[model samples]
Target: MTTKHLNLKFSVKDTDAIRNMAKSGRTAYAIALWFIRQGRPVATDEVLRVCDDMGVKVRKSA
Candidate 1:
């Protein structure tokens, strides 16, 4: 099989939008880590709840 390349173009507005989204994702990841480090089920539950509220779907890979 041959490798395929994809071409994508982002306008200024699109760049800004993705930047904000990436920033939010980073913040969410940090908060989740903090919750996990608390060693409390409640904290972890809260993190899952927030993720659900934000429509984040996680799947385990085998």
Candidate 2:
């Protein structure tokens, strides 16, 4: 599958790609958007910072 980036550097985890469309659960996109809404979604590290700051842990792909 091809994902069109929003000019955002951070890459969402493969696992959270689909399940993150909503806010009911924690996912990469959801977490990233949370930062974008805060006016800080330009770099990959920044995106990761948002999730880390929020204590949302992304699972590692095997």
Candidate 3:
């Protein structure tokens, strides 16, 4: 199996968009669309921050 990876940095506007999507309860959709549009992944930490802002609990893997 081959795993493809990319290193990406988010712009100010992109960060703002993530937060806005989180606030509007559409974080997943926003992130997915961004990936489809840019062919890159958003920062995982940015996603976690959005969850934090929404008070969503994230559990670690065992």
Q: Pick the candidate with the highest lDDT.
A: 3
Candidate 1 C-alpha lDDT tens digits along 1-62: 11122213333453343345434554434444543565622233443344344355422111
lDDT string, candidate 2, 1-62, tens digits: 23333424444552244234323454454555665776855444544444444455653221
Off-target runs (Cα >4 Å) in candidate 1 are: 1-31, 35-42, 59-62
* Total backbone collisions for each predicted model: 0, 0, 0
Ranking by lDDT: 3, 2, 1
Q: What local lDDT does model 3 show for residue 58?
A: 37
Candidate whose TM-score is highest? 3
Q: Rank order by TM-score, top first?
A: 3, 2, 1
RMSD of each: 14.3, 11.9, 9.9
Q: After TM-score superposition, what is the CA distance of residue 42 in candidate 3 from its true location, in Å?
A: 3.5
Per-residue C-alpha lDDT of model 3 across residues 8-60, encoded as one tens digit per residue: 45455655666566556665545655655778755555556544554654321
Shift of residue 43 alpha carbon in model 3, Å: 6.2
